[model samples]
Target: MKKLFILCVFLLAGCATQTPSKTPSACSEEQACTIGDQNTVETMQPLSFEEALSFFKEKKSGLLYFGFENCPWCQEALPILREEAKRQNVSIHSILTRDENNELLYTEEQKQEIIPYLQDYMSKNEEGELTLYVPLVVVVKDGKAIEGHVGTVDDHDAHARKMTEEEKQELQKKYEDMLAQLSS
Candidate 1:
């Protein structure tokens, strides 16, 4: 009995000391919200208009993510974006447009440059006005915008739904393929 007890304790200790895997899983809203700060992408600071233009001009191929801190979709999308970007070895730039309270954070000078760039990615309404959306991602290459995606590729009803591991893999693959196309 004494030997058995010791063995059990050793097994429990081994299990307890095992390291957790660093592989990312599909993130919940709670996890996503706190995973990283707003400057999680390659550019640690918010880019000025000239800086942003210069980045695209120099890099010629990279991912641009436009989001606000408080936007639910942005919160949900960012974690997935980070993981896939890292895996695919893509450089990502983040543009923050608002604060947690939905206050505008971009300067008018910044907006003057950013708005026109984003307008190129915007969808048109029947009235021919630009329809802008939050959590937008633009794939750029050779100083041209290749494609733009709006919103999270994962389920939008994130608060009420959780994706399975297979679903997460599929979403990651989709992003990988999209990025590959842009690079190619």
Candidate 2:
């Protein structure tokens, strides 16, 4: 009985030390690729948020998508960004919600630093400038706001048409519109 009690104590202590499990993949192929749209998102070019911001600052405009891995909408939105990047011949970087295995090469420190920047720039509301959403997007250029999504997913009518051709076109238009808003 004493040995069993000691084992239970050891197990409990180990459980306390364990980190939470990592989030799951956000996208499946069904949501990412489809046919027949000008806005089709079939591929992705990745860069960290900081790199994207630097590129955007130099280019005079940029788009940012902030989502975690385990989020369903985030999974859907990521492919849309990739498709847009590929069709447009651009690069899109993904900032993982949590990277326990270093798959995206995001260190704990880097992840900590990037999340704040994204939350501040992308999720801020207009009236209060405070955000309460997880999957958010922001369009910025020349230190100005263009278009921002507090919680809109990529599959949203504003950004995509789902896995259809028309949907692709819509997504493309939204991307261009967002850019125009930022660059103007």
> What C-alpha lDDT do the candidate models reach, one value each?
0.62, 0.50
lDDT of model number 1? 0.62
Model 2 lDDT per residue over 65-164, tens place: 5556655555555555555555554433343433443244344455454444455544445875444354555666654444665443344543443345
Best candidate, lDDT: 1
Stretches of candidate 2 above 4 Å error?
1-60, 100-129, 153-172, 180-184
Q: In candidate 1, what are the lDDT values of residues 98-179, reduced to their tens digit?
A: 6557877556565555555667767776986565566787787776777777765555455566555675676666667767
lDDT of 1 at 132: 54
TM-score per model over all chains: 0.59, 0.42
Residue 73, model 2, lDDT: 53
